[model samples]
Target: MIILQANQLSKAYGAETILSSIKMEIKHRDRVAVVGRNGAGKSTLLKMIAGELPHDGGELIIPNAVSVGYLPQQAVLSSDKSIWDEMLDEFSDLLAIEQRIRLLETKMGSEETLSNEASYNKIMKEYDTLRADFEARNGYQLEADIRGILSGLQFNGFDYYHTTVSSLSGGQKTRLALGKLLLTKPDLLILDEPTNHLDIDTLTWLEGYLQGYPGALLLVSHDRYFLDKIVNQVYEISRTHSQRFSGNYSYYQEQKALQYERDLKEFEKQQSEKHKLEDFVQRNIARASTTKRAQSRQKQLERRDWMDRPDGLEKSVAFTFPTDQVSGHDVLRVRDVTLQYDDQKEPLFPSSSFHIDRGERTALVGPNGVGKTTLLHMLRGQMPPSTGSFQLGSNITLGFYDQEQAQLRSTKTVLQELWDRYPSFDEKDIRTVLGNFLFSGDDCLKIVNTLSGGEKARLALAILMLKKANVLLLDEPTNHLDIDAKEVLEAALSHFSGTILFVSHDRYFMNQIATKVLELLPSGLTTYLGDYDYYLRKKEEEKERLALDALEQPKTDQEDGAQNESKESFEQQKDAKRKKRQQERRMAEIEELMQQTENEINALETALLQPETYEDHEKAHDVQLALQQANQTLEDLLVEWDECSTDNA
Candidate 1:
């Protein structure tokens, strides 16, 4: 069924029209991803469909009795209610039905001449129907279902009973709202950037849940991976128009390119034909004998359906920064670092040691709250380490770009902002830089407050370019950028010879730009000489080994009892002279081994990057073999250490 349909939909804010002549049909069971760059009317479309906003010029037809649930980009929940009560409210309809059924059951059991046969029969019939409906909808297991959904979304072991909505963090509130929407089981689900704050595990669960959802889904998200995993179709709002793609995001990209090529070819053919017809008509129009032919040609020209030329990324700014002076050999150095926020109880990364060589592109990776941003702040000199010290080499200036660009002035226009930041830059230079970043003539007049997330990111990046710093520290630099803008940034980073230390969750972006990956774990920070994908594979191997060892550990009563005694003894003698000597020797050997492997891996990477070596089959094969061995050895060592620790425990 056509669950939702829009015709001639147009929305305007003041004189600026965000959407014009938007038409779309949302069918039942269709999973559509509404995609566009930031500030591309995606949220506005959802609001219109949800009846939260009126369309200025459009006809909207929604089927009667069809329910629609909308989860906006930002959602607020009632503060007085606990998480448990918030979810329970989704089933208000079911609760009402249950009340009626209960009342009927009570009457059926009463006296009044054995309940009058006909009335009793009617009551029983209604009860049976309601019961079946309830069962079909999984009503009886509503609490369990709600609990499962919440748990899957990483609310496991949480005290939802006491945790009120207002007490929950922003991410928690969003999850709570998501749980409610799932329980409501509406005919249409509209979600905006639902995966913005979700962790990998939670996102995976959401993908599975949405896959089995029986209703239509309209989701707007910048998470390409999530959209590709969940959505079957893509609705792209572009350049004052909306285009539909018949397949997943990856397929849409492929098809879009193919369609563009086909259109260009067709247009070329039509233009060629038109030119020939025009030539024939112009030459024969004055000849009496050929007047009929000229008239026929003119008619053909008037009747022809000329093809419109394909336009590419509309008004996309082309930006590139001038290179800066070379930095010292040692760009940044940290020794035995230990950082702790005043408000945080735990240290971010203690006993951490790292060195950033000039022109090395590194990606800092970890789960949320694992100190990715904290580490960046420490590097930028905005925050000091609790213990130890860090140094920036002489002549190595830093360009720091926080997710929330702190330097932006809300009251300043784009030009004024640029000028204020870089007084040395002439107007021509400023315009050129802005143009490269996609900010054009009148766009330069836009106030900071009016700019979208992508625009802000772009503007911040432009400012970074003007600084001409030899070292750049970025935290979630791609957080607010669309795919196109991300591509632009990636291109800039790829060409940039300066040292870069970035924290980003975008795996694709990391793969393209990261020359090395640093993983921050509870134990310490470990640097791997490769991109994010390489690190992921090694991490997975280590995880699987740990899981396998955990499964195979001795758990019998006799084994447990023996281990308990041994553990006690071991702890008691942990500080003894002999034990301390043994521990130090083993630790020294492990450290030495890690360093040796790192050296070997670095050599192999250097060779792999060489054009001549990569082209040679034998040399490339050798490099690959050496890299695999080094990575495998590192993973094996980690697993072995984990296993020994578990056994000792």
Candidate 2:
């Protein structure tokens, strides 16, 4: 069924057109992605479809019966209700139905109603209908559904029953909003920048969930990996026009390039023929013998329609990081480093050690609030580690790109921001650099504070390019960049001779530029000697190996017992065996407790590391104390397990 259709849908802000006669359609279960550079009106188009904004012209058709849900980039949930209650609100009608069914049951069981066969039957029928409706809606599994979605969106670690909606971080609120939207199960779901705040694990789970979603999905995102995984159809919105491609983002890229090439060739051929006809008419129109032929050619030219040349390639920021000198073989070495925020709660990672070699691009990946940014800060000496140290190799010069763009002077103009730093450079040279970054003419005169996020990112990269450092430390460098800018940065970094240690949630960017993957867990860091895809494959293989090991463990134990049965007398062996079994059970229980304690400590540590907690002295202190207690319990459990094993032996 066609859930939505927009024919020549046009939206404009006063005189400025945002969307120009755009056509799009969404059928049942269609997965469509809207992609373009920043300021290409992708979000505006979504808002128009969502009915949050009025279109200036054209028609948008959505079936009256078809339900639609829209999630914007920044969705604020202003409620005093707890997370679980807020989610339950999505099913208020079902809950009301359930209550009605209970009331009907009460009426049927009353002696007054039961005495009358007609009334009893009527009440029972109502109850049955309500029950059927509830079951059809899967009302009994409501809590399970909530839990599943919360877990998929990485909210399992949260205390849903106690945590109020107002207390959540912006990202957490966005996730909760998404969970609520998913539970509504509208016929058409539209999401804008849905992957903005999601970590890799959550992104992976969301991709799978959306892939199997029953409703049609219309998404606007800069995440290429996500688009490639979840979207089957891609709509490229450029210059206020929309072009549809019947495939994933990768397929769209390939097909778009091919289409452009074909159009360009065709356009050139038409231009060539037109030029030849015009030349012949000009040379022969004056001659009496060929005048008739010239007139015929002129008439043919008037009758012919010429093809307009295909649009020139869209303007994109050009990026390159060239170093005048190469770093030593060992670019960076981190030894037993532990990052801790003020008030000194739990460490980010427990005594993690890793190294980056010269010319190697290592991607630092982890869940949000896992201190990926802190680690970069420590590496660059912007922040000190609570424990241990890191060192740069000899002759290595470091360049840092802050995702926040905090290094840029807000008081200075865009041109001055670069020129002030490099005073020796001529005005033309500075303009040349700015032009390459897509800032030209009056654009360079804009103050740094007035620039958009994308512009700031470009300026930062332009500055980084001029630094010519041998070692680069980047914190979410692709955060504000559009798809084209990201691709440009990826290409530049791929060819960069310098070593790179960067943190990013963009899996596609990592796949393109990273030679190695560093996964930071609460336990420590694990290095995967390959790109994002390779790392994912290895992680799956590891899970399978562990599963198989677990399945064979009991059999291995039984075999060992069987082989030892004949080696001893019945009574003595039986006594020892019983003691051994008891010890083993105790050890297992202690080990489980130890693991739980460690997890609790890690969770507390993560909580303390959050900006809100660290900023509050009392909260940080309480969490720090809890973390210490958890650590003590874990230590005692380990000692008890060791003693038990010794006694059994």
Candidate 3:
């Protein structure tokens, strides 16, 4: 059922129209995403839909009984009650029903009620109905769900009953707010930038939970990976308008590029025809013989409806890393480096040892509070490690992008901010760099302290670009960047000849940027010599392997003669080589199947891009659905491959 719909919806701030003639709809189980560049009115639209803000025009329809839960970008909870009590408030109806069932049970056992046959039967019937309702609403699992959601949000060890929401940090409060919303299970779940503070593990869990969620989801996020996994439809708001696309983020990107090309070509076609008509009218209007024909052509031209030029990416940077002076083969080297505060009983994390070669992008990932940023600070000489040391290669200039935008809080004007960093750059050159980042004449005069997060991020990037560093250590570089900016940044980093070692929570960005992954555990660091997807497969395989080993407990030593019996049996199995041979054959089969599935997927994607396929909406959808199935097949094949590879190794 259609739970929400908007037609020509609009909003304005006095004379400035923030959104115009917007159209949107959400069905009962739709997984929809609203995306656009920063300040494109995405949040404004969400606010209107969530009923926090009223629209200036047009219709916003929501069914009377359909509940809507909105979690804005900066969601927070503040209450005097403990966190657990606040969460329990979400299930008060179920709790009430449970209480009624218990009261009925007590009444049925009393001697007075049982004495009247008809009343007793009525009481028993009521009890049965209430019990069914309680079970159907999952009254028994309410506490379990509260615990699970809180734990998933990283509040596992906290005293949920004693820790009041008023005592938590802003980020912690936001997490708790999300957990409470999950428990409520409203008909429509609207989340804006929900993945902002989630770690990799929590993100994975949320994705699984939402995939099976019974209610509809309306999300706005810059995390493309999260969008790709959760959203089935995309609505992009641009230039005070909205356009709907049918697919995940990746598919939307693919289709958007093709659409841009199609638009450009159509405009060029019209321009060519328009020029020919104008030329004929100008040259022949003076001659009586062809004057009538020319006049007719002019009328036709005047009557033609002109298509507006396709506007896209209004501000874009011409960005590249020019590696004039190359670094040594090894960009960085760390040995047994660890960090611990004086008051801590143990180290912040285990000793870490890793190396980055020139031109490699390494992703540093861990759970929240695992000290990923602290480690980067130590490597950059901003802090000292408690143990061991790290070194940067010769001739390397290190550039850092701090996620907090700490350097941008100064009162300096935008122009002065860049000028302060590169005093060598002439005024015109400084202005040019700032312009590329969308800081214009008056914009350049705006104080840095007043810039929005996106503006600050842009300024920070402009500084990074001009630094000319051969090695980059970025901490959450994409934090406040819009999707457009992140794409441009990804493209720049992907082609950089320099080396990169960065920490990020964006899975899509990690996959796009990292050639290797450094997993930082509390005890130690582990390295994966592949991309994020590869690392995930191996990680799962390691768990499976440990489980298998645990199930096979080694036989204890028996009498002296029989002590080595189990070892002798394993030796006999090795001599047979049957299991080893079977594993090898199975591994080969998995590899072959993987290749075949990938080929099928690629073929489907190619077909999706073909005019004969894409121009026909029905055909394109069929091919896209097939492509999704094929990709799922490939993932399954990878899991099997991991199982075989781990055992064989």
Candidate 4:
């Protein structure tokens, strides 16, 4: 059945129509991935479908009884509620039903012998029905299920009962909202950029959960791996239109290229035929012998229509940095670099020693708070190391892209920002450079605050590329870019002849760009001589080595420090084993529930299939309740299975 259908949907803001004549349909369990550049009206369309915003010139048809839950780009939670209370909202209706049944039972037991025979019979029947409904729903175990979801989403170690919603940060609030939405179990789930602030482990957990989701889902994200894992359908939203591709992300990319090639060939053929027909008509129009034939061909030519070309095609920018001078062989050197923040006892980077060579591209990787950004700051000479010496090669010019984009002035217009950065450039030169980065006529007039995150990042990058630097230091450069823009940057970096050091969590981006990898563990840096993929392989080998070492080595006084060093490794193994046992127990329970629920569902389906079952309304209602309970219970069980598997992995 169609869950949602929108026809000729259009949305306008002020005088501009952001989405015009849009149409799409979502089916019961279709996992649709939405892709588009920033400000292309993707979010506008999602908001319209979710009923959070209204459309100006269209209608959205949602089939009756179909439920939808939408998670916005930012989640808002009430300050007064605790995380536990907020999650409990998802099961409020079921809890209310159980409460009502409990109260009825108490009243029945307290005072009352029914005065009338019919009243007593009605009371007994109602009580029996409610008990069966409650049991079938598995209403008792809802709290346990919710707790598991919270833990999987990275809320572990926090007391859910005591943590109030107001105490959480933006990312934490968004994660909490996601957990609640998952527990709500709507027929359709809509998430926009859900992985924005998630850690790698949290993202992996979510991917597994979504891959096995039974309900329909639609999401907008630039994380390729996440989309490829969860979504089956890809919807490409261009500036003027949208098209559906019939597979995952990789498949869509290949199929889309083939489609464009085919269309280009067809277009060429039609143009050739139109030209030939025009020539024949012009040559023979005046001659009596061929006048009739020419007229017939003219009609055919008039009836011919050309296919419209696809929009949103950006011509590849063909330019590279002009290197006026080469850096020395030793691009950079850091010795005994111990760093610490004010009021923080732990040094972010302790006694780190490393060197960079000319034209080398290195990636700095660690968890969020593990000094990747701090290290970049130190390298750029922005911050002083606590105790150590650092040196730069002669004739080395540094170009930096920090998270703040410090070069941009917030109050300036887009054109003003570029003009101020390049004061020596002529008016024409500034425009030419800005045009390459998609800044045009009125767009350039917009203030910096008006631009989206991706646009701002692009503008910042465009300015950075103009600087002729031999050494580049970029921190989280690809944070807000779309897939297409990311590819553009990747291509540019591949051709760049400068020494590059950047921090990035995007595995694909790192693999394409980095020639070496630097892992910032608690113990300074462990260097690897290859890209991200190679680092992953080496990491697995290291883990195996540690597992073997655990079996071979024994404890000693001198080895106490070494044992302390291996604490992270030991903790991970312990967690892995604990998760494995938890998964086994949960999987067994879920399997039992799944079988029981399936049996109940089949029994009700059989009853519904029979003509006589509909005659008694009470029996029919009872069976319907049973079917609904079975479905909810099965959904809960499937979610549990996903969480267990994620924990184990």
Candidate number achieving the greatest lDDT relative to the actual structure? 2
- The TM-score between candidate 2 and the true structure equals 0.84
Note the residue pairs that clash in candidate 4. Answer: none
> Weakest 10 consecutive residues, lDDT, candidate 4?
310-319
Clashes of 2: 0
Pick by TM-score: 1 or 4, better one: 4
Clashing pairs in 1: 317-438, 318-436, 319-436
What are the per-residue Cα lDDT tens digits for candidate 1 across 218-240? 98887777776677678889875
Highest-scoring model, TM-score? 2
Clashes of 4: 0
Model 2, 182-265: lDDT tens digits are 998899999999998899999999987997688999999999999987776788899999998766799899989999899999
lDDT values, one for every candidate: 0.81, 0.88, 0.87, 0.81
After superposing candidate 4 on the true structure, give the runs of residues whose Cα lies further than 4 Å from its correct spot. 97-141, 309-319, 349-351, 387-389, 521-524, 544-649
Candidate 3: RMSD over Cα atoms?
A: 8.7
Name the candidate, 3 or 4, with the larger lDDT value: 3
Candidate 1: RMSD to truth: 16.2
Candidate 3's TM-score: 0.83
Error of 2 at 45 (Å): 0.6
